[model samples]
Target: MTSKSERLKDEGSRLQVTAAGATAGLISRFVIAPLDVVKIRLQLQTHPLSDPLTHRDLHGGPIYKGTLPTIRHILRSEGLTGLWKGNVPAELLYVCHNAIQFASYRQATVFLHSTLGEGTIPPSAESFIAGAVAGGTATAATYPLDLLRTRFAAQGNDRVYANLREAVLRIGREEGFQGYFRGLGPGLAQIIPFMGVFFAVYETLRPHLTHLELPFSTGGALAGTIASVTAKSATFPLDLVRKRIQVQGPTRNQYVHKNIPEYRGTMSTARAIVQNEGFRGLYRGLTVSLIKAAPASAVTMWTYERALRFYISLGERSVL
Candidate 1:
């Protein structure tokens, strides 16, 4: 049987985990909303979709002119709620995404230690490896739901699918299983670095800051913010490509007009961005991404940590 003191420690840990996880979910919603808006626009090449004549311009022009103008354009034409287009799917996806991410990372870390005889925290490279695998796996598992979310977000209350379930069912029925995994290569490309750097940097910084005796939340938030910004910046190009691929369809014919063959796949997307929008194209939604990711990642890490701590505490009490 567990001792009373041991039970209290475990209970405390469990409470911490629960609190952290919930807060992380809330934070991700707020932070990612704007970035999500921009990413969708750039990925879908909104202007091309909107204009019938210049629709084929996507083959050789900037998908999005710039961030502020895009936001203003969306707001003016679509309304403030337009900024939060497809927010329902976005929020729901985040909830499941974060739930899987936090829970898996925790479990993965333990598995790593046991299998590899590493410490609980693993090395920076190890953290990145584990994070990439976990992030990629989670994204793949949830790719269809994510695809639907991207479609809804891109269409923005256009009466596309009735809801998420309908969206998934419709896609599977209409496009087949492969349709659900559309843009997977680009998505995985983005997630590997996004999750890898996110966890690696956060894990590294958190410990160092803690050693300096700072409060846990303060350190976690700081580390999380930095990690999100860095990770988002590094992976911005892949993000742009993923969005484009996810939204490609007969109905979504914008990216098809270019005469170039290279624009078809992952490498071509990158080349096109460079040729068309220059470096700026790669970071079309970068500002919004930073705005969203900082808070979201910060809250996610903090909340997840708290939730895990709490769950452990409860387990200890049960043992006792």
Candidate 2:
């Protein structure tokens, strides 16, 4: 049985971890907001199934070409500010999402370790399961903000949202409450595997890399970047499906044809992409997605780990 002091120390550590996670999330998401904007825009790009010859022209034309071109176009058309569209909601989503996720992950990990005992399962497996649970919980809690962020980012300069309140009101008025959770199914599907692999890889690699004597932040960044790239590459299809589902509503621009029945739900969207555009269609923005995820995740995890270490040090000093 744990002593009272031990329990209090554990609680203190958990609180610190939660705060660190939130700070890391905010800074990282803000730094990569532009990349996130481009990635979402690319994912939301539509190709006409009825016209094979004009598909490239319609979907992959000058405006929605590769990442660099798309960036240039946004700059020329909407200026530097265009890159940071929806940043407010994105920041909110990240801060809340990470706080809940990392805190829950820590709690879950403790519970699992206590129940199963150390070494009963591999650390990597434990981290993976914990991450999945945390990710799902975080997604469920903050999904409304996430939907709004995606919609705002995908909107570009076409629609002006006065503020977060106005965006929420407009979505509520136009799409109803259900609109806030539009792509929840696909989002969870993607997040589970994405975060599972992410934490697993990070936990597995961190110890090995730490032996190299690199700074905590550097090691964290390296492990996080590699983990994020690997996980994102494997789950890019689900992300595309989620983005497509998220942008669907009466007020939003129709990325898919109204005539197509498969674009309506998660499974249907996957089926439609496979039927109309082949398997590759599901990986529409994989390159940009990976590019954005790697750096953003690196920064996020580095900050999280660094902040966690700082808090842990403080806790140790307090205990002393």
Candidate 3:
């Protein structure tokens, strides 16, 4: 009977993991979608082409004055649907990414405790390590999909990619296989530190909330906000680089457009953006990212943790 109960508990944990992951994806999207639209527009330098008056030369590449105006511009020109550009790919990537991120973090935390044998609750450092590993592993596995997602997002709100499958084929045919994984290195660089800070701050804050007697959901929201700010602050430069590489000039086969100078690879894109736009250019969307990321992370982590706890509770009752 004890063995059966344990088995039931294990199954419950797995179900909790899955539910938590799904909720994380949903929450992440809801929080990030608008900011995502702005970030991509900033990254793609969309304003320069769309409206002559709003564009300005900042440190280098074209810059927009602020988020509210930019959003207004997109809505005016592209309609309400413009705000959710590339939503399909974004949703797809979020679903897959969160599944791995949340589920693996739970398993990894358990594994770390077992392997270390100290078991007095894993340290914050352990959480950071687990998150970095999870983010890197998951990103590496699904990076090509992420690249496509970025491309779809970065295109102006007025543009469309037909479908993800069509976009993938077009990219491969026009840009070669390596194009599919553009900016992967910078993306990984951004993610490792981002997740490291994310989980580290979150773990640290969770206990503080428990001490304050706050509900778990409230604690989660607080921790996630802190984590998101810290993570995005540390990794914004790499994120800029990732965006640049992911949305480079026209592909080799697209003959209609005049050839902008070609970047040989991700390194070239980084060098070009830096040399041309200066350090500020490397953090093009930094402000908007913070605005978007804080709420997004707050909801994602809060939703994921609560969902996991609820599912686990249900599982336990069923076992009893």
Candidate 1 wrongly placed segments (more than 4 Å)? 1-23, 46-68, 119-122, 156-159, 211-217, 254-263, 310-320
Instruction: Put down candidate 3 lDDT per residue, 1-320, tens digits, no spaces.
Output: 45323443464465578677877886688567878978876765522223345454433333455788878866776677768777777777787788888777766776776677433545788889889988887788778777776766555432436678888887888778887788888899889989988988888887777444444447667778878888998888788777666765454212111122355465677677667666567677778988988778767877776777788888778889
Q: Backbone clashes in each candidate structure, one number apiece?
A: 27, 0, 0
Across 169-250, the per-residue lDDT of candidate 1 in tens digits comes to 7777877878888889998989988899988998788876644434545677788888888888898888878776776654
By lDDT, highest first, what's the ranking? 2, 3, 1
- Candidate 3 CA-lDDT value: 0.70
Which 10 successive residues of model 1 have the least lDDT summed? 253-262
Q: What is the C-alpha RMSD of each candidate to the true structure, in Å?
A: 5.8, 4.0, 5.1
What TM-score would every model get versus the actual structure? 0.77, 0.87, 0.82
lDDT of 2 by residue, 1-320 (tens): 88423553455467898899999999999899988988887776655323445223443232366788878878987799989988998999999999999998888887777788766887789989999999999999999989888877766454646678997898789888898899899899999998899999988898777545554447767888889999999888888898888777775543222222236788888988888767777887788888888779888987887787788888889989
lDDT of each: 0.67, 0.79, 0.70
Q: Name the best candidate (by TM-score).
A: 2
Supply candidate 2's per-residue lDDT for 206.
82
- How many angstroms is residue 231 displaced in model 2 relative to the true structure, after the best TM-score fit? 0.9
What C-alpha root-mean-square deviation, in Å, does candidate 1 show against the real structure? 5.8
- Give the true-structure RMSD of model 2: 4.0
TM-score of 2: 0.87
